[model samples]
Target: MLFDAGTWSLITDVLAAVFILAGAFLTFAAGIGALRFPSLLARMHAVTKPQVLGLILLLIGLSLRVRSWSAVAMLALVVAFQLLTAPVGAHLVSRAGFRTGKVDESELQPNQMEPDDDEHTA
Candidate 1:
């Protein structure tokens, strides 16, 4: 069997473990950041950014170990959906938080009481 029980060899197993552990560590750090960040926007950024990369790493590790096309396809879909939705979710959360006065407005620009009036100013 190519994978015997789970891994093809010690190297692959070790690599998978490394990737998974690193991903888990990043996720843990995100969790900590969510708790330690000063405000809602900071917390949303902490939860969304690293967590997406962490999820990618985790799915990669799982794909390496699982070695099945169907599983890989599903994981791919999960990654795709996450990439698509994470930013939207973060935006919604931060917008709602800002509207609810949970955001740190002092950190914003002097004229940023609302978003820039010029939509093309990016």
Candidate 2:
């Protein structure tokens, strides 16, 4: 009743195209940042943040284009797995770098990872 079927279809197609292009741009930027950033933490940040968002956006566009519940469900699962793993993987890598002395303590603010000196006194 609101919009004709043809107009609605056109609108969805336009939106899908916009989402896909934006997602692709963000994914490309993430790759560039991962390669260009000077520090491990910076690279991890680049890989995790924009990469996840780009994947989510790309999947949304795909779901819109496919218009199938099974495909959307599978895409949602992929997004869920990505969201769940990226941070955990980043944390593990950063922790390993910190423990192995690959990470510079000077770059860390506050440096809470260091054991407090007072704990041994008690």
Candidate 3:
């Protein structure tokens, strides 16, 4: 009950194609959302979330196709840097937007980041 080498190779190829297509689609969608979204936070969400996932998917597909440990190590480093940086970058952008009043206060739910009048007076 085992696939032959050729069959296994074909299966991996198909799966790799699927992942690559999905990753491409998500990356495309992220671009569209970044352009179309009206708000800074929305654009940030679009850019950070889908792009990171898309990148991971793309790297996974590449690894599957390349089937080389060295290539995978490089891809892993890419993903690691992406994972580490994307969130921090998003947070910084969002905070900058909020502080600069680019984000409308009314749209924020909870709005914990809003500065209190007392703090301003002090």
Candidate 4:
């Protein structure tokens, strides 16, 4: 049996709300982490991770509300693009920060870096 307009509207509204709330929460958490993190790399992690997820959630919510194949396909494309770009963007940011000496070595543990090999080189 097909759902009536009223029921379909209610269901769509509820799903949309859920997706929006989840996306908002993810974005808020990312913002908090970016603010609170001690290092640039850490902040990059927070922003990249949650931003992608949040966008995906928001897109999914929008797709559900629209209830059309084209909308869903567009949302899927958006999700795919984000997934492909977010990590590469984060890596580029982190690498740039590292190269520019923007990141504090003191914030990272000594063991995290490779050991000196002067003896082996000699």
Find the candidate with the highest lDDT and give its number: 3
* Cα TM-score per model: 0.81, 0.88, 0.87, 0.79
Candidate 4: worst 10 consecutive residues by lDDT? Answer: 107-116
Global lDDT of model 1: 0.87
Q: Model 2 Cα displacement at 79 (Å)?
A: 1.0
User: Which residue pairs in candidate 3 have backbone atoms (N, alpha carbon, C) closer than 3 angstroms, thus clashing?
Assistant: none
Tens-place lDDT digits, model 1, residues 1-122 = 55674445666768778889888988999999999998787899899989999999999898877878999999999999999999999999889989999877888768655576687676
Q: Model 4, 69: alpha-carbon shift in Å?
A: 1.5
Q: Per-candidate RMSD vs. true structure? A: 5.3, 2.6, 3.9, 3.4
C-alpha lDDT values of all predictions: 0.87, 0.91, 0.94, 0.90
Task: Report lDDT (Cα) of residue 117, candidate 1.
Answer: 60
Could you tell me how far off, in angstroms, the CA of residue 112 lies in candidate 4 after the best superposition?
8.2
Cα error, residue 12 of model 1, in Å, equals 2.1
Which sequence of candidate numbers ranks them by lDDT, best first? 3, 2, 4, 1
> Which runs in model 3 stand beyond 4 Å of their true positions?
111-122
